[model samples]
Target: MYQPLAYRLRPKTLEDIVGQEHLVGPGKIIRRMVEANLLSSMILYGPPGTGKTSIASAIAGSTSFAFRMLNAATDTKKDLQIVAEEAKMSGTVILLLDEVHRLDKTKQDFLLPHLENGRIILIGATTENPYISINPAIRSRTQIFEVHPLTPEAIEMALDRALTAKDGFKDEDVILEQSAKRELAFVTNGDLRSALNALELAVRSTPKNEDGTILITKEIIQECTQQKGFSHDKNGDAHYDVISAFQKSIRGSDADAALHYLARLIEAGDLISICRRLLVIGYEDIGLANPAAASRTLDAVLAAERLGLPEARIPLSVAVLDLCLSPKSNSAYQSLDRALQDVKNGKATTIPNHLKDSHYKGAAALGRGLTYQYPHEFSDGWVAQQYLPDPLAHTRYYEPKFTGRYEQALAKRYEELHQKKSSSTK
Candidate 1:
């Protein structure tokens, strides 16, 4: 069998693991569990290629326990029965179940008794959200640890280890340039497996020179992965991930990283998605920080749509950079959500009679707008009156976050306009 480079170069021990320090680092939960040889059933959850299976394999090797691998998708109850029988024959079993959330109710039910008796130590790996997809009974038996995505630096470290490992290309005279390494790391989007696979393809496919040294370049890496490390399906999980990263980078004020993902989206010919997501990031994430920025981003998005692909990126990038450098606040979205939640939970009450629509005929006859106070007649166009329903007359939802100059002014005005006696004095 031609094993992939990622599998061959998988981290064999807990110490060898590169990313996910929260779980595997010294004094961390998983590492401490391994050091004491006190293994328990664990369900590792995260995106693909984030080392969930690798960690399970590392635990089995370190503990000297008999390791068995199974896929929930293909394996049946009968296969699990065999594993259980093996656990009885042997001392203990470390079962690495990949895509474990797919295991049906019957298999999950069978797993509980074995887990309780400590006959089989289950190490399930899944890309889906385990809490939502996995059987609750299975979750109750296992410690759930979410594996975070590897950073570019972590991915690059894995690539380097593969290039020099004894089981890897250590014997081969491979010349990987620095630029190629960075590009590969950036393009993989924190997926170490993708990085190793791309490197393997690039190295094996490239022609050797007269000196028998295989040279790997930036172009070669791009050719293998396609479109300069922008291997994204517009409709896939990767597309959502990149868009999320892009928006978060901008919110974090990391202009360079934001621009990099923006470029990636453009390369994938996903201009419309980018434009739409940028609008959301501007208003939702960058809300109240610079209110003008949201409208400006909308204008920029319109321009990008009008200009189209090749040149559309120009305006889109401008908006991304602006949003990246701009201050960020989610107060608007959060406050609106608070109000929405209250309404959804039956907090919505009758509209104040004075504040009802009175422009229509006979609205006054119903005493709808009779007692309404005109704010313009009061000083500074500000009159303290009930605008919300009677049940929520004093409920304040939209509180301004003093982030940017614009929101700072809003904060002061909001405080003055709302602070008053228990009831409206008007």
Candidate 2:
């Protein structure tokens, strides 16, 4: 059976792994474990194509242990039993369990005792957070290490190696242009497997030149990657991460960074998410400080909805730029949160009698609106009177933040009313 370039080029030792120096580098915990021949069951969590399986295979190779592969979601208990039997025969085995978070009770029970006795060194690999997704029983039995996405530099190094490695296209006259290599590395977004797959596709599909060399160019890579440069999986962790970065970039007042994230979301065709998050950022991050910017954000969102994608990005970009440059303040919502907390805590919450409705004849008889003072009846359209419940009459919640001209005026009016109330009380 023909193997993929990625599978064929799998690193056989810790030293040969492309990224994850913290785990596979010299003197690291994993490298140390292999060096001492004292292996243990561990879970490796990270985004796909970041060397989790490679690490498992390398460990098995380095230790000369029996290596077996199985998918926790798809493999049956019988398959696990086969590995267990092999472990008993060989004394030990390194098992790479993919999507280990999906391990069912049946398979887990069968594997537990083997793991405990060190008969099978379990290397559980997952793209999900082990703490949140894996069972506590399994989690407690293994040390968890996070694998990070490979950096562009690390991916470039891997691409360079693949062009000449024996298991790669070394024998073929595959002339990968420097720019093409960078493009492949850039488009894959730190996924070495994706880069290798694209590289293989480009090499096989492109016709050879007169000199008998398969010339891979930037155009060829772009075609092979199919505009995967801004690939986004809407149901994956990266979706939330990108949205978080998008909002944070706007909150940090970095228009360039905000637009970059916006572009990624645009490529994903996620106009609704873009609109929703921008609307939230307007109120949550830029409230009161630049209310006009918030209003314009709404307008841009409306325009985006009317126009749909491609052109929608224009209004979205305008809104993002406006928000990124707006004066930021969360005090408006923060004050409401304080008041909400008081309500949730069940603090004294009876409505003051004077502030209650007095429109009905029976309301006056019930002591409603008896001492109420209408602010509009005063000369300045303002008056000092109790509005809060008795227990919270003196409590303060709306602490104004004067981050912009508009909020500065609001703060002035707020202080004026506070002073008048104090004087009235005296």
lDDT of 1 by residue, 295-342 (tens): 999999999999999999988988988898888889988999999999
| Model 2, residue pairs in steric clash | none
lDDT to native, each model? 0.88, 0.92
Residue 85 alpha-carbon offset, candidate 2, angstroms: 6.0
Clash pairs detected, candidate 1? none
TM-score, per-candidate, Cα-based: 0.69, 0.84
* Per-residue lDDT of model 2, residues 310-387, tens digit only: 999999999999999999999899999999999999985889889888999799889998998887888999877888
- The most accurate candidate by TM-score is 2
Q: Over 4 Å off in model 2, which ranges?
A: 33-41, 64-66, 77-93, 101-121, 129-143, 169-175, 202-224, 346-377, 389-391
Q: Pick the candidate with the highest lDDT.
A: 2
